[model samples]
Target: MLFSESIRIAVTALLSNKLRSILTMLGIIIGVGAVIVMISIGMGVRQNVTNSIASLGSNMIIVTPGSTNQGGVRSAAGSSQKLKLDDADAIKKKIKNIDYVAPTVNSSYQIVNGNMNWNSSVYGVTPEYLNIRDLTVSSGSFVTQSDLNSRNRVAVIGTTVATNLFDAANPVGKNIRINNQPYKVIGVLESKGQSSMGTDQDDMVLIPLTTAQERLLGITYIKSINIQVSSADKIDMVQQQIEELLRQRHHLVGDKEDDFTVRNLTSLMETMTSTTTMLTLFLGSIAAISLLVGGIGIMNIMMVSVTERTREIGIRKALGATFRNIMMQFLIESIVIGVIGGLLGIACGISISLIISKFTQFNTVLTAAPTIISFAFSVGIGLFFGIYPARKAARLDPIEALRYE
Candidate 1:
């Protein structure tokens, strides 16, 4: 028979057993759908983290006091008192690559503006904190050197805080109380949404580091040190130089343990990307097992089909059909089932990824490559599993098949 005639025959046979064909493709459908969903989530998570890191600035370097690791258990990033305000001042005075430095501290307290009250986090940093956090003020102005030097009890509020505390009223020059300590609002920072770590950035208060250390927390040790480099191109040199400087300052000799660690956000981001990508690939492979099961389902159904059509095959051979024609017809039928299932799987995967991106804050992108690969994989599965059944059907003896019926 011609190829078209063979296709017609194959399609007719598949249509005759629609319910069986659909049941057979179920495995492929589930497998492909699962693989797509897992990959989508993994990609979304990676993208979210990348965006969060980007918002923090590539030139930003975070310094926290403490040992990093020992015996697979890590101490807190900023648990020790090795990082002092003097170290921060030293870096500012000495480091050429460093453009800005801010010793940081934090506390959570109920902030009240007249009758309105809400609990919020208070960040203690110097005037240079804006450069370190990659922040800009939307109204009024940032904390200046004068404010820090004079230990001004002025605050820069986030957009959410701006809305909450002042309502429709302008927040500049207004007084807000943090744990009943009054601070004049000097500025309102632009909104930063939520970070990858799930912290709301638009709900904090900012105060001078000196005031926070003396009046509020009453501690000389800074929890963190934020530094802004002049340029990202100088990051590696800056990181190395800072490490060497800190080691020397901390009195580290030979293999003696250093008390401080410098965290380069760019390096951290690269590690996160590499780790997430590998994990996503692993998860994708695990999901591909379902596709294999689906392929097996096709083979199982094909085997059943060959058994049912034994008499028909014998009669067709008696009526002049060749073995090759029978094989092609059956193979085409199997492939068609796979193609249909694959298309459906692609559709389902795309829809799900879009829904995730829209409803949640993560970035779930459905690119063309994965969709094409998924469908192609489904079709390939059909070809790999269909050959055996097709060959077996083609090898059947006309005389034996005829006599058996």
Candidate 2:
């Protein structure tokens, strides 16, 4: 028989038993759908992490106070008052390949603007903080050197704070009280959206570091120092230089643990990427188990199909149908089931992924590569599982098969 005739026969046979065929294809459909959804979610999570790190700024490094040991009880990181504004200045002056340095201290405070009141983080920082964090003033002017020098009570507010306090107002040249001390709002920052950790990036205020240390918080030490490198290639070098400089300044001799921690964003990004990639692979693997189970279902169903059609097979063989033709017929039937099921699974997976992204916080990403691969894998599953049943049907002795009842 011709190949097309075999395919026609196979399709006819499946159509004759529509319900059984659909039930047999169900496993493949579910397996393929699950795989696509899992992969999409994994990729989405990885992308979110990458974007979150990128939002911190390009070619950036952060310095913070390390843990301290007093009376053999180690305090939490950043609890020691070691990082200072002077240290920030020293790093800016001494370190090469540096673009900007922003030393900052932050505390939560209840901000009052007349009858309206809101709680938000208030950060004390220099003008460079804006450039370092890739933030721009959307309204009015940012803090100037004059503001730092005079310890002015001027502030820059984020978009979230502006909305809560000013309510669609420009917020510039307005007065807001922090801890009962009235301060002028000099600027409003553009929205930065939310971070991977679900932090609202646009929900805080910025003020001059000197003003915060001298008047507001009354603390001399800064909580953290953010540095922006001039180029990507120089980030590691600059980080090393800053670490050595800090160690020397703090008088840390050999084998002594430093009082500060230096971290480059590049290393952090790499670590996060590797971790997320592994997570994605793990999720994909777990979902692939369903495909294996689906393949087993196909084999079992094909075995039963061959048994039910024993008399028909004997008739065809006695009527001069070759073994190759009988085998091809069965194989084509299984492959058709897989192909149709795979297509349906792809559509279902994409639809569900889109629905999840629309309804939940999770961001789902769909790409062509995974979809194509999954479809191909389903087809392979069909071929592999169909082999045993197809061979068994083709090898049946015509005389005995005719008497199978």
Q: lDDT: which candidate is best?
A: 2
List, in order, the clash count of every candidate structure: 0, 0
lDDT tens per residue, model 2, 324-387:
9899999998898889889988998899889999999899889898899989999999999999
The deviation in Å at residue 293 for candidate 1 is 1.0
Residues 162-190, candidate 1, lDDT per residue (tens digit)? Answer: 88878888899999998778999999998
Deviating ranges (above 4 Å) for candidate 1: 68-74, 360-363
The model with the greatest TM-score is 2
Instruction: Estimate candidate 2's RMSD in Å.
Output: 1.5
User: What TM-score does model 1 achieve against the real structure?
Assistant: 0.93
Model 2: runs farther than 4 Å from truth? 68-75
